[model samples]
Target: MRILYVGDAACLPEDLADYIGDMGDEWKVETVSDGNSAMFAVSNTTVDVIIVGPSLPDLAPPVLLGQIRTLRPETIRIALLQATEMGSTPSIRLIGVAHRLLPLPLASETVLEAIHSLEELRDLLDSPRLRRAIGRVEHLPSPPHLYFALTRALEEDEGNSGDIAQLVSGDPAIAAKVLQLCNSAFFSNGRAITDLRGAVTRLGLATLRDLVLASEVFSMKTGSNVDRAALQQRALLASRLAARILPRTSAELGATAALLADVGLLLPGVRDERQPLDPDGEPDERPGHTEAGAYLMGLWGLPMPIVEAVAFHRQPQRSSLRTFWVPGAVHVATALAGNEPVDEDYLKSLGVLNQLPAWREMAGLMSERIAEDAA
Candidate 1:
């Protein structure tokens, strides 16, 4: 991979050159001090990755990144930011364009690890599809800070629904939505479930966490043409089915993966040029919704299983698991929830084809139950 570094040289580690040299010829590193030189280097050569620092002499990091994106849309953009500059205006703009962000006073090891992780995920997604999908991703919503807080709270031995509800209640909009959804037939069982703690208990922490994330993200596109309601319902159903399909040990991961499976559809420019699948339900060579969603989630620092599951939910066969796992569970659950058929041949290879009938039955029961609840 060829990487171009732009901005103040002091922002990088002192040993960066030595580290790159030890990695051999597979990695090419180049540095330019200003935006003009950086653009010249980019226009002249094919750079796989570009790391830009905030102290550019000629232009700001965001302006340079925007130019780099227009010039080589496929290049991976990484922004380096000081601690104080994290939430500043420039950093916010960088968040919309850059693929990754590394802290200022960059460590050589951290940089190497970041690149390695990207390479592995790229391979899993197939390089061309990964590149194409990521290139078009103009923005990734900021990580759900509330979701992180809730996750940390749950990790405590004393964590309970009440504490989680208290934390969630701080955001009036989200808290109201939680109550509204919990009172709906989908989560309710006839009695009025009015309290946040009770609703959290009913939904389980994993489900509640994802709901908050979905709510926060979908709310961002309130005026867009996207059918947010339909997408949310589909995600909820898929999550429920995934919880049923996966073993208890892996159920949470499976359910979370299913819940956010269609999130890519909400991203700007991701679906602008979507390609339809072929007659046999085979995906086109271009990365579709799955890859798009996975790329965003991955950038947000979500778990690998969740990222992998979302990436391959439409085509679970792309994953190399010999046994049913989160990806397979999510695939089956998402397919069944969306009224698409499960790939029996794929299940057969994992020796789980016999379980399909039972899953379909569960799905049917779920549908009937929801209908009855609605009535």
Candidate 2:
């Protein structure tokens, strides 16, 4: 693993290098005192990850960070901030550009944990063949024409939340995704968001713009091989059910995980297990949809919390998170929705077996809600 550091943190009474010294032979850390050196190193070398600090002497951190994204689209970019910058507007603006932000003085454990999680996720998704295949496809992030039309309507002075909700409600797929997201891990109160307008309000105008314009997870054109309606139906059920699971941790987050959990199913070689002999006779090594979706989400710069759930939902035991949060909720949600089987042994191990009946009851409620919505 190669890491690039773009600032000096000696004034914090801790030397970055000393704190993270020689993570053994597998780890290589490079230091650059300013933005220019950082850019030079990035141009000359293919570093796996880049870390930017607030003390850069040359370019402002945010602008340089955006440039880094343009220069190396695959490189994982992270930003460090002084505690003082926590409430600053500039720091807030950079949040979209940086993959993750860490507050300084950076703890050694925190830094190592971040590095390990990044490497582990990349390893899970490191598929050159699938990526090449996806690259061969042209212009994939195309939302329906109506989504664009809705965006235009919202842009007009006369546009309002009611109009947006009505427009969203007209499309079952987008409307369900948005509602599931609003009610799931992204945002949740005790009340279920039953209408599109309520969902729009929860998501707000800014997030709405990003979803319509920047988000690719929802924009893939439906294919003949994949049943679009059934896929979405399952997503709605799993998400709503997942939202109800582990509400103490976060309902919206769990729902978001379950909603997008099966996204890897959209990838090649991860479908119905009826493989006829391949003409080429080449072995296919693609990971399942959970890892594939998590990888794709990571590449697209989705938040780590969501990515963690998507990646580990298949086998929540694989994740190191102790509490029954994202992984636990998604694992149970997937099972309850019939996307996968529940591992009773695993739940028993975690001492959460008592929660199973409540989850089944919630699944029943979700199905009833879906039926009413269809009506």
Candidate 3:
């Protein structure tokens, strides 16, 4: 694999090059001091990953990264910054560009782990066609009006949860969905959540921001031939189930992963409403919504755990983190709560085959609660 570091030669992850050798992995690391040289190199060579430092001199971070986005959409992008730079204007914009953000003064071990995780996750995609296909997208679709309104509010000097809630309240459908999740068993704080403000407060602003981005983007282009309502209901149900079943710290993350697992179905090359191919069938021939959704989540800079869980939820065996936390919660939720077949062999391998009856019961109860609340 080839990795490019674009920054001052002095600050490049030159030490990381030697560390990569210790791992016994055949990889090459190259550094370019300015955007001009970076662009020149990429135009003539293939690089799997690109790292950009905030200290870049010749071209602005956005300008340099924007060109990379257009030219090497397949290349994973990482933004390296000092802790203080995280809240700067350019930093805020990096949210839309970089796949991952590594704080400076970070250990070489951290960089090593990140690269390995990213490489493994991409390897699990199983479909070269899908990767090439989704790479062509400029950015994952965001609900145009809502996305802009949300971001604009976030940019304001004093923007708070109330402001975001008020903006969200303007759209009844979006407001209703956000509130439903907050009041639901997964995120409920006890009494009741009747207002969008209360919902945002309960979920906290950062989580709400991510939820908006994921849910709104996933909501676009509901397939005309498919049951859009059913699809959405399944997502909410799976999210709630995953949240309930996972540990407290990662509950919301699991919910987000489960919620976005079907995002791939809404993207091109997979929105045909076709039945899922058999679990053991050739992956290239499958609908590949899971892999498709993962690619977008990674591009959106969503955390690796969420992206991995969503990507492999359909076939948990594909993930290396075989512990039954995020991936397991999402897999169980999607299969039991959504209208899909369970991978019995995969479950059995994880020694969770016997646990399905209990999971289905829990998921069934939540499903009924959702129906009653909607009524």
What's the count of clashing pairs in each model shown? 0, 4, 0
Look at candidate 3 and tell me the lDDT of residue 46: 93
Which runs of model 1 end up more than 4 angstroms from their true locations? 1-120, 124-138, 222-224, 272-286
User: What TM-score do all the candidates reach, one by one?
Assistant: 0.63, 0.61, 0.59
CA shift of 358, model 1, Å: 1.1
How well is each residue in 1-375 modelled by candidate 1, as lDDT tens digits? 898899878888999889998989888789999999999999998998899987787898878988987799667778888967643433334544665666676789878866775555566555675666567555557777888777667555447778888999999998888787777656677788788888787778877887787667767642237788887888888888998898775677787889888887877555422245457975445556677778778767565568878888888887655468888999999888888878889999999999999999998888888778767
Q: Candidate 2: where is the Cα deviation over 4 Å?
A: 6-22, 30-37, 40-46, 53-63, 80-96, 100-107, 132-227, 241-257, 267-269, 272-287, 294-308, 317-329, 339-364, 368-375
Task: State each model's CA lDDT, in order.
Answer: 0.77, 0.65, 0.70
| lDDT pick, better of 1 and 2 | 1
* Models sorted by lDDT, best on top: 1, 3, 2
With candidate 2 superimposed using the best TM-score fit, by how many Å does residue 96's alpha carbon deviate from the native?
A: 4.2
TM-score of 3: 0.59
The superposed Cα distance between candidate 3 and the true structure at residue 116, in angstroms, equals: 5.9
For TM-score, the strongest prediction is: 1
Residue 372 accuracy (lDDT) in model 3 = 70
lDDT minimum window of 10 residues, candidate 3: 86-95
Error of 1 at 194 (Å): 1.0
lDDT of 3 at 294: 79
- 163: Cα error in model 1, Å: 2.3
